[model samples]
Structures are given as C-alpha cells and as structure tokens.
Target: MGAAVGAIVIGASAGALDALSVILPALPEGFSLPVIVVVHIPPDKRSVLAELFQAKCRVPVREAEDKEPIVGGTVYFAPPDYHLLVEADKHLSLSSDEPVLFSRPSIDVLFESAADAYGPALIAIVLTGANHDGAKGMRAVVDAGGSGIVQSPEGAFATAMPEAAIAMCPTASVLSLSAIAAYLQEV
Candidate 1:
C-alpha cells in the first residue's frame, strides 16, 4: 500500500568495479527510482564516481549535496570523506561524523538513514567489497521492510561483502550484476 519503491541504495567496494560499469548501463532509462550509492573512496581523495557513471548510465549522476532533495531518475553518490544520509522528507544530509568500520562514506550510515526515512519503500543492494560494511545495513533494510540484495559471492571480485550480507540476512537475494539491473527494472 505504500510506495512501490521510493529509492534504491547501492553499496560497492573495491573489487568488481569494472563489472559495475557494465551493469549500470543495463538499467531502465528514465527510471522513476532514485538511486543512492555509497562507495569506498580514500579519505583525502575526490570521487570520480559521478563522472564515471554519468557517461555510462542513462540516469543523471551527481555527488550528494548537503540538504539536496532526493529525486527520481537521478543517481546520487556519497561524496568522499562524508557520510551521506537521507532525511525523513527524502532530502540528503551529509556528515563528517566519526567513520564506521574505518569508512567515511559508510554504507551503513546511508542504509540506516534510508531505513529510518523510507521504511518499507527502499531497496538496498550490496556489491563486491573487502570489508563487511554493508552487512548490518542490509539487515537494517530487511528489518525496515525493504528488500535487501547482494551480489553473488561467486560472481564478485571480493566475496567478503556479499558473504557478510548473506550471513546477516538469509532472505537477501544473491544476484549477478546483470540480474540485479533486471530485477531493479521489475521491482
């Protein structure tokens, strides 16, 4: 009865990044779902994720600005050195608060905030990474009545992240990158 899908949040790590470039293009054009991405970038560096995705995805991609409104058909990246959060009204909030799991732009921060703001209307996808950053957050999504998905461990360049997510939540779907894009279209 609530929103079918208010947003999609993706958490990615170091490996399998090249494959993501391939997977992003397969998403439906002009999709109404807003996408928020949390990627591990070095603390002092600037993110090229927006620029990289801009060329590959049909949807507009930009770094999340403080207090920016969350909009559909757009992809917002968590800027390096800050944790990006979603507000109750579906706007963005950026914080330089203490890092979790040694990550500034933490996947858990975004996922937890999204769970609080959107509740049942969110979809969380955890991709390849060396750490277990997204596992707790994916569990938060499931607890908030949202869907939780992870890249299949066998398909990932780094299996730790997906494996952790699966360990935390059994119902989390393990999907290939292409399958994830397709499922997003259907969801």
Candidate 2:
C-alpha cells in the first residue's frame, strides 16, 4: 500500500547541507511523517552525523541499522559506506553496493528504493549539493506517484543537486530551507 500522508526523503551532498541545523529545529512537534536523510559521508571512517544532528534536532536521531523499523518522530541517517533503503514494510535495509555518483550512501539509491516502497505516499526533497546524484532518483519518486521538492537554487549553497532535480521534474516545489521545513510541518 502507498504511504497515506506521504513521506519526505531528503537527499544531499556535503557542500549543500549546512542549513539543515537551522531548518530542522523549526518543525512542529505534532508533525509525524518520518524523515529519512541521505547525506554523502566519507567511506573510510565512522560518521558522527547522528550525534551532530542530535544537538539541533528536536526529534530523536539515529544512524540506520539493518532491519530496523522506521518510525515517525525519529530522524534516521544512512550509515557511511552503505546504501540505505526503505522496505515496503517500512524497515531499514543497508547495502554495500557500488557507489552511484561516487557515493556509497547515495541519495539516488535511497530515493529510488523509497519511491518503490512508498509509491504515492512518498515525498522526495533534494537539498543543496555539489553533485547531481539526486536528479535521477527524484525523477523516480515523481514517476512512482510521490511528490518531489527541491530547494530553490538561489537559496542553496551548491545549486547543482536541486537544479538537476527541478530540471528533471518540472513540477517539484522549489523553496528555501526554512520554507521547506515549514512545508514539512504541514505534511
């Protein structure tokens, strides 16, 4: 079954991820959609992203583990060196597949899988990034009946990723980071 209210999947590369700290805290407490963030991390080391996000995020934040069930009100980050996928049952699946767009925790892989799992119930968000990794998967989300959002290229630090997403899917909502957070609150 498709997600009933739609889920938001945030995709980004390193350079374009700075504003998340500010945007994350502004979301309302009653908002219950699960947010899965796919940020590119270096493969050679363990990621402190969960810990880092824990400081600013009002919701619980943790690194994704294999077979863990996805729950609302928690933030889940893809562990380094693995591709994170959303199962039809809404559990986490981690894979060591080859990198796409030179990223193991590829945003595209996560978005594509989530699109398949959630169908029209998914909402894909493309954030600031130096690479175009998310474009293809954002398209997949749209193709699968999910809504797609891209941060306004003018507001993004690295416009390539969001630009690519919007270029590929003309219907995506383009907003600033703060606005994106506000929009998520309504979800």
Candidate 3:
C-alpha cells in the first residue's frame, strides 16, 4: 500500500482449482491494472490457462506473449515452458532461460522483473504452491517498495509457497483466499 498499484502479479503451483476459485470473482469487467499470472505446469503440456480463465474471468485474459504491450484491464498468464518477464518499457517478454528451482515459468523471474519495471506501483501475490519458488520473488517485490501479499498458509491447499513467502517477507499481508479476492475487487 506504499503507492497506488498500476499492475498486479500473482504466482502459484498445485493450485489450478484454488486459483480458479479466487480469481473468477476478483476482477470485475473493465477493472483497471494489468494482472500477470504464473501457474506452473509440466513443460510438455500446452497451457490452457488463458483459455480456461478467459472463459470465466470478467476482464480479458490471455497468455503472455513476447514483445506484447501490457494492457490495463487484462490478465496475462505465463505460457508453459517459458519464463515470462516484464521489460523496463512495460512490454511482455518470453525467454527460454534455464529453470529456477526446476521451473521454467518461475514466479521469481516474473516478480523480480515486474518489480524492476513497476517498482512501488506493483502488487505481488503468492498463492498456494508446493515449492518455495515465490519466496524470493515476494521479497524482491517488497524490497522494491511494492506491496506483497501471501495467502494464509492455514487456508492454502499447499502451504509451503505461502509459508516461504511469509518467511521471506514478514511485512507482507497474509490473507485468506476470500480476503485476497475481496481486496482485489475493492482495488
């Protein structure tokens, strides 16, 4: 809450169903702010997240594309097997970089890059996941003076991600999924 957020970035794994539940009603049609998401999937599997969320989300949703301009009122999910990054110019970039923590579309990669681009005007959220991939990323967001939110571990389907994020950034808000969704709606 240090600055008015112009963008939001969220990361999760082992959380497709949980993400769907929290995201569907969180964004109203035409809501401002570009939302970027990364939910890990096997590299060989084609990502259907954009299609899945686009059907249910009120705001426009699509998979992030290389060199694409980040648009307000839209949600862009990281494509599988690629690391999604936000350029200084606020364009989306896809890299076939080495995996971090065994994940190609690393939450850390996106969050850190987005923090560099948006700085204090970014909001980063870490949802349910099985690994510690998002912890360092959430720390980066907070260190950049952006707001960071972590799902309450008690309420998460897989608690490690949120717990690690919380450990990395103690000042981050810890909220239930419902609370997180409500906060998004009110933002």
Candidate 4:
C-alpha cells in the first residue's frame, strides 16, 4: 500500500486564499484523510475560508470548533481569532492564547500539535505566506517523520514562509500550486 496519510495540515498567509482557491478545488470527492488548515487572517475580521472552499471543493469543509472530533474526508479551518490544536486523541481544540508571531490562528500551533498527534501519518504543507510562522512547525513535522511539502518560492506570491520552511527542512518536496493539488490527490 502507499503511505497511509491520516491527516494533512496546511499553513499559509498573505496570498493564501488565492492559493487555496487553486489547491482545494482539486481534491477529489473520495479523499479519505482529514485536512486541517491555518491561514493568517486579521483577528477582528471574520473568516469565510471554509465556506469559500466548501463551495468549490468536493470535500466537506467547515470552521473547526473546539472539542470536535477530527474526522476524515473533511476540510477544517481555524476560526479567525483562536488557535487551532489537535489533541493526542485526535480531537480538535481551540485556544485564545496569545498570538504567536502576531498571528492568532498561528500555523505553527496547529502544525506542531498535529505532528504530535499524528506523527508520521501527517503531511504538512507550507504554502505562500509573507512570514515565517510555519517554518518551525514544518521542521517539527519532519522531526516526527511526517512529510513536508513547501510551495516553490518562485510560485509563491510571498516567499518568506516557504523559503523559511525549505531552509529548515531542505529535503522537503517543493512544488507549484497545481502540483500541490495533484500531490494531494495522490495522498
């Protein structure tokens, strides 16, 4: 059998929505793994990313709620002002804890927690972003034997986050937006 991916965590900032619009729509309806995403948004603004993706993607999508059980074949996005975390038991949690690197729904928090919870079954994707929020978390995912995929800086609208992650995990697979979508289909 191919690698059994239990969960996929994606982190993005800056031009993330445009990137996600391209990526999310490409996942097939039968995708069986859970996808959790953290994209930087202004704390005061409402997030409709889940709804936006849900409309275009085949898989069901929703804003992650605190204490919800993590389920397969669904896409979950962190709420605007809270940090999303994955528990060891595969449950979702939300924290109003102080922002990390000025992002409330910090990508690092979700990626690190998911790495701890899913270990090698996890696949972490660091996409286009203007900041380094997901770099350390991508390293954590790699340390836990999970796969790390970074959007090639040439394709990213903002290169800092992907570049940082690639710097930390030099062996990570680098792909373009459409290639990432295709990779998810394979996973």
lDDT digits (tens) for residues 23-129 of candidate 1: 66677787888889998999888788889889888888899999999989888999999999999999999999999999989999999999999898999999999
* Per-prediction TM-score: 0.96, 0.94, 0.97, 0.97
Candidate 2, residues 1-187, lDDT tens digits: the string is 2357556788878564486775667666665878898988889989998898888777888899999998987788999999999998889899998998899999999999999998888888888888898899999999988889898999788888888999999988899888888877766
Q: What is candidate 3's lDDT per residue for 86-117, written digit by digit as tens? A: 99999999999899999989999999999999
Indicate the residue-level lDDT of 72 in model 1.
92
Q: List the residue pairs that clash in candidate 2.
A: none
Q: What ranges in model 1 sit over 4 Å off? A: 1-3
What is the Cα root-mean-square deviation between model 1 and the actual structure?
1.5
**lDDT to native, each model:** 0.89, 0.85, 0.90, 0.93
Candidate 4 per-residue lDDT, tens place, 1-187, comes to 1567899999999999899998888989888999999999988888888888888999999999999999999999999999999999999999999999999999999999999999999999999999999999999999998999999999899999999999999979999999999988987
Candidate ranking under TM-score, highest first, comes to 4, 3, 1, 2
lDDT of model 4 at position 55:
88
CA RMSD of all predictions: 1.5, 2.0, 1.0, 1.1
Superior candidate under lDDT, 2 versus 3: 3
Clashing residue pairs in candidate 3, if any? none
Better of 1 and 2 by TM-score: 1
lDDT of 2: 0.85
**Over all chains combined, what TM-score does candidate 4 have?**
0.97
Which residues of candidate 3, in runs, are more than 4 Å off? none
